[model samples]
Target: MEKLKEVHVSRDEKEAMLSEAMGQWWLGAIGTMMKTMGPEATMKAYGPTMRQIGRDRASRFIKEKGYKGHDVMATASVIRIWEKMMGIEGQFLEASTGRVVFRNTKCPLSGTVPQARPSLEYAM
Candidate 1:
């Protein structure tokens, strides 16, 4: 048996590491789906599933983050935080009603795997 060693990771580094892992996992999942279901079918099936996942995740985030107030902006706020944590580059647009909208122009997973683009929309 070998002794285990412990290493320290800063909060920012941990976040970055987790983000990278998540991006790679997403790419791999899309690749697997595309190979198994073909690109068009994969997009059609994967898109809705991803959208639901996004909605579910946003709901969980709002609850965990203790975002009190109207539910309208809760999802948006959690999503913005999530996007930043995941290192997605984009702009936040201000709607007429003062709600901020996030749009990602560049995503690591989508850039590498074009077929994964639809997943990005759901994540937004």
Candidate 2:
């Protein structure tokens, strides 16, 4: 079950703080500070998130490193770390670019991708 608690912080402040970290993830020292802090400190530091507002300020790529599978409470802080590190207004740095490498027609790399005729161009 999701733990419900009454903390303190304004929505605007929370957004500002998280977005600030998201935009400036290169700062390793501050990130270290966050990693070392306790759970309560994390909540206090990054509180007041809204229901509708997403963790990212931009596209889906920004959330590539986000937690998959069941939503466990233990990794909430780590999720925040990833969000701050990757979530931005554009392409995500952490996610693979959905790239699939395929061999050319004559290149003997694999027997899987058969050579296609001129009529059918298979997009790998």
Candidate 3:
């Protein structure tokens, strides 16, 4: 009983906090410019967004053509591009003080790369 009480925190909680901190750092440093990667920012952020947009459209493949979105889903670099703003896609503005909260990564049961599972996107 004492051993259990002695425990300070769970590993999951620590990892979550760490991940959030990293995300905040990204935002503080370049998230603003990345979201506004428009005439107000650089072309680097643009590439990721464009890729995400294309990927989103590709998602339609499941319904339109029965294609899965697995490998593409797990790609941290790719998902992070759209994860900005909590995957709130389709707009220049988001809930984060006019700036988008970029993810650059996916979470368990959150966003998955194109997979064979039909539950992913209404499956084909």
- TM-scores of the candidates are 0.62, 0.19, 0.30
For model 1, residues 7-122, the per-residue Cα lDDT tens digits are 99999999889977887887888878887888878778877877788768767766897766555465566666766766678886664344666667876555566666665654
lDDT over C-alpha atoms for residue 77 of model 2? 34
List ranges where model 2 is wrong by over 4 Å: 1-30, 49-124
Regions of model 1 farther than 4 Å from truth: 1-19, 69-72, 98-105
- Cα-based lDDT for every prediction: 0.71, 0.38, 0.43
* Position 6, candidate 2: lDDT: 83
RMSD values for the candidates in order, in angstroms, are 3.9, 21.4, 14.7
State the lDDT of candidate 3 residue by residue for 26-104, as single tens digits: 4344434533443234334344664575667657645686644455233433345434534433333333323343322
Report the error of model 1 at residue 47, Å: 4.2
Best by lDDT: 1
Best by TM-score: 1
Q: What is candidate 2's lDDT per residue for 76-108, written digit by digit as tens?
A: 334444434433112323322343222233421
